[model samples]
Target: MSDLYGRHKAVLPDWLALYYADPIEITHGEGRHVWDADGKRYLDFFGGILTTMTAHALPEITKAVSEQAGRIIHSSTLYLNRPMVEMAERIAELSGIPDARVFFTTSGTEANDTALLLATSYRRSNQILAMRNSYHGRSFSTVGITGNKGWSPTSLSPLQTLYVHGGVRTRGPYAELSDDEFIAACVDDLEDLLGHVRPPAALIAEPIQGVGGFTSPPDGLYAAFRRVLQERGILWIADEVQTGWGRTGEHFWGWQAHAENGPPDILTFAKGIGNGMSIGGVVARAEIMNCLDSNSISTFGGTQITMAAGLANLTYLLEHDLQGNARRVGGLLIERLRAVAAQLPGVREVRGRGLMIGIELVKPGTDTADPETAAAVLEAAREEGLLLGKGGGHNTSALRIAPPLSLTVAEAEEGAAILERALRSRVQ
Candidate 1:
């Protein structure tokens, strides 16, 4: 191992996951690519878990952060910050929640934490509902709501969390049903769970379960459940950390796929808004957001530099209509990958919307997850000068592809070809 790798292993937690056996230190990046410490160029398809929103080292984002840093970097939330207010205004308008109130945080975990605080306080209930095979964040509170066994490390939590079904469409009891039937069954399950437990403060879900290998229920599944939750005054918290800001191609927000009822009551977002800068936030109507009796402030939540980065990133994303680009390019990429998956027996499913996609790895003949080969594929792809990400329910066997929203059709084709080679070489 390299000296840096040795130091990392020595200092970092043992559970901190690294992609390849030999991790490459990324030195610099521009556009859709990044260069490792040894001066090797690679197509960064994962985009730092989809945080590098528009592109890596985009000039606009760089200029904004630089300009803001030169002026004022740190002004605590106690003081007024112009950039923070401006960015929050933009987000509130885009968030689709009526009379929305925006509160920024440093990461998705904090945003969800704040959301949970608001929900429980507003509803006067400590009981919470979370979708099965879903991942929200890593904090103590967020972990309690995370239903994925691989990600949730502890069962101890301050609040009582109940796991609900219908997050994954392919490998569950509802897998055999049609889309409409699947929605109905999931709604029935949610109703049954509600009847058994004390009324939950909220039902937290990701429109597309990100760390669960990009799996999602059929479209409109959440809408069906919304009606049931509405009657009981249980808030619907849409964890848009990975699925927000038009990454999903067809819709600006993943929840738009299920817009039959309306937008979610509370929405938590992060991981893409400020590109590489740390920025996460929660949006809710004025009433729910004002429910907190105690004063709450995020120390580094909406720093001027980060807000500048966010404003710049959002501007570039909207002005250039990168959302449209995601739709056109991601559609072609998924189709190409589906064709490739058809030829590979180890491939189980090619799924996702927009730039967010997942290729599930399985034993060639059996339906069992093949994490060993999946790791081999990740190693092979890195060796081929392409970086990818791995995620799934308990197995961690799915290849995640989420290039920047600005990914071109040519880049998509190139990444797909590299992925095809990686899969073929790894799977028997």
Candidate 2:
């Protein structure tokens, strides 16, 4: 394995990061547990960066993919693709956008990029609005809208992006305000920013900032902001790459938590829907989606096999009521983790919804982020046969926990116990 790791480093890009000091090669997974190449079993907490939404190796999705592959694998969008239409129809019905149109992509980056393109084309402006400490994707255009300094590698972009406040409720200047007050302040800021610039095409945001350590503003913040944007005819784009597909437990989509102004003009989703297959997409009103004058297609998007797998995965989760399972199981898990966090001084905050949770660590008796301690806890968790993930705008100082939506109560308790032990190792 070490030899393979050495070879991986030699061949892979230097920027592609791996978890743990000595990364474990995951050989296989079932339910909420995965086994490494060394045959050590571990509870999976991060869900492959919140992508393996359903349990790993779900038989229904596997069977669907197999059957589809046996019949046909790939057909360019120039030809009719039944599975793609079926998947899109289901998504459009569930999207809540009136007269919705769905466009498939190969990854979240492409989905978001498509959203940007449609917004810019429809509104005829190159300006955009984003949230502070938010991450959209790694593509050049998506990265331009990313406000996280750690993730945005370049300042150059085709679009003029203006970042807004109120994404994080705990650390910013308006952190001390009440919920209503926070929303007001953010809206005022947005209005003020607009006064100084050209009319922007749209405002893009995540209901819960994923790479920003699962932090989010008070509910209705976006609703409040949307009111201001709508007056100016700016579209709202909800980036649900990590927060979609009932991963948050409380709602089918994270945007529902702030549906006061109704659904966003455009919604981008990826991760989890295909349950490990490559599937990403954008949903919007027909007007916005059809704004483009020229035709465009994603070569690898909506392949027959992937669409079949996605359709089966979506059906299985809905039929099995996995969202309800996420709600019940995630509620208990968060309460358990909160109880544990209360005793640990290094733990600053434990925040999230459903299976998507984040534990922000800070130096004891200080407000500064403690990335070293967070990294140490991650290593300790791995040693104890538990896999975890790290994220945060503050040098990756938060521990992200997003297990499969089907995680059992027993698995949650076990993972919590191991994590408690790992966290306590800091002071012991």
lDDT of 2 by residue, 133-251 (tens): 99999999999999999999999999999999988999889989999998899989999999999999999999999999999999999999889989999999999999998988889
Q: Which stretches of candidate 1 lie over 4 Å from their true place?
A: none
Q: Write the per-residue lDDT of candidate 1 for residues 43-95, one digit (tens) a residue.
A: 99999999998999999889988898899998889999999999989999999
Which stretches in model 2 have alpha-carbon errors above 4 Å? none
Candidate 2: the clashing residue pairs are none
In angstroms, the error of model 1 at 269 is 0.5
TM-score per candidate, chains pooled: 0.99, 0.99
**CA shift of 294, model 1, Å:** 1.2
Task: Name the lDDT of candidate 1.
Answer: 0.93
